[model samples]
Target: MDGLDVLADETALLLASVESLDIEDLAHPSNLPDWTRGHVLAHIAGNAEGLGRRARSMSDAVPRSMYESLESRSGDIAWRSRRTVAQHAQALASTQADFAYDLAGIPADRAGDDMEIRLGLMVRIGDLPLLRLQEICVHHADLGVSTYDWSNWPPALVAWMLPRITASFAAREGFPVGWVEVEGARISVGPDPTTGVSGGATEVVAWLVGRAPGSGLAVTGVDAVPVPPAWL
Candidate 1:
């Protein structure tokens, strides 16, 4: 299956998980610092709405910003947080469907059209789906539920993300500049990547995204494996 198909399946899983949660469970803290599960769901729905809006703008050749402001985003999430778990689940599912609907009209040939994202940086419209997939996959695990983990990620998604994420790390300022080996696949990042860190692809992705400690990874040519800052 293609990445978008895989994303659709994964999103179904996430929706099922959210739908299964008890109303009280919404108040529980998520893996992200200081945010509750409700907050996470709210953000997910809000993101879908934002991306859907952008897709519409792109398809129609209309100019629109993906996000109004950081403060507006936070406020919207806060407003959505007041809803019950069922309400939040409905919102997430509806917004996700809307996003998929919007994307259906955007063919690959036109996906590369320039568009501005939340940070005011312009990027290809084609990148929107991948970004949404990342959010769903990562945040599903972040719900702190027993069913989800780094290893639970789709193998295709893992393979696809490995190079992109490592390349992003390599491009960052002050990155440790090292070799990361994930289950025999080795990638060198930065100008002089002298140190080598080896581990399972799951652990590597988790650590690279700041979602896990590097305890499971083996390090060589360095005193310790440096934890990277949260991915942008």
Candidate 2:
């Protein structure tokens, strides 16, 4: 499937997975620092709303900073998260439904275009919403919700992202770890291959995102250079 199709699948699956959780489950902490499951869930809802607004207003010169104003949005998210999980599920259902349609309505060419739109200070829009899609998938893991991993992430994306992940780490100061290479579905660091942690792609993707790398990567691979976040 193409990027947008993958996007739709990612969105639907995330919504379904989160919806299955108990609302009380939201209060549980996630891998993301200082963020409860509720916070992560709210973040997804908030993200859908934010992206939905942007996708619809692509014509407008809305500064991404508007969406970056997460604090203003968090009050509502936190408040709603207090409701029963079913309630949150409804909210998630509503938002994802709208976002699915909003994302779907985007012209195939425009969505996959090389043009980069600033979604935040650290984010840009390019290449079939790779970053956006990454956020949803990674956060799904962050929320302690299991659906898919880098194994499910597109291979082309993995190859394109591996160099970027390794190189970005090299450019950073105290990020941790080392060089990385994505050979087909596997990732290699220096001479050694991946060990049990999530595959190199997942590990690299998670490592770059400040979360635990999943499987298939050797955590000991660091011989030179700090590990870098897998930035798109």
Candidate 3:
């Protein structure tokens, strides 16, 4: 997939959702508990800005932190969340444009270079676009301003993310060990499974990631559907 192209499309969709909001709408609570729509919009802008900074550093061969500290990141989001709709929209557009440009300019040889995203976590320079795509697509739904939801996620994005998310979730402590059946394809989530969940690919992916409840899914060998812990 042309990750940059896909990222641009997703960014546009997210911006459209943000632009449709009014000042009052921004103050309304989002699907995410305790976060107003303004907070979600601010977070999306902040994420783009952080990722763009990383992309610029990658192109320059000067390593830089994605965020100075977790506290600063939180503060920045809270401050930006109070901006007018126009400012929020502008920040989103500009930061995303910068990220796309910086990502496209990275030296081909550096694509395989590893960069520390957090204290102990590292990611390939080439993978930043896909990571940003995930943030935009998932958070757009979190805004809860429209009919869009997990089912609206691009098929290619869902296919690419489902297994990765499943693996991450399965590794967590207390994660249920069972099979996950999506569209007739059954995959073992953990060893010695005694239970299973079945659903369409999008629903399964959303449920596994804690973005959606187990509405369209079926549980077998268990009294209730297994709910995954919050995804990072």
Which is better, 1 or 2, measured by lDDT?
1
Report the C-alpha lDDT of model 1 over 63-98, residue by residue, as the tens digit.
777778889999998888768877987898899999
For candidate 2, write residues 1-232 as lDDT tens digits.
1456666677778777777787567788877678888877777777777767666554344544336555677686677657667766777678767765655655554543443334423333334355456567767777765655435656555555565565554555544433343344433333234221233555556555556533345544444334344454
TM-score of every candidate: 0.90, 0.68, 0.92
Cα TM-score of candidate 3: 0.92
Residue range with the least summed lDDT across 10 consecutive positions in model 1? 115-124
- What residue pairs are clashing in model 1? none
134: Cα error in model 1, Å: 0.9
How should the candidates be ordered by lDDT, best one leading? Answer: 3, 1, 2
Off by over 4 Å in 1: 112-115, 120-124
lDDT of 2 at 151: 51
lDDT of 1: 0.81
lDDT tens readout by residue for model 3, 95-179: 8888787787888888888877667556677778877888888888889866567778887678878877777767766667478
**TM-score of candidate 1 to 2 decimals:** 0.90
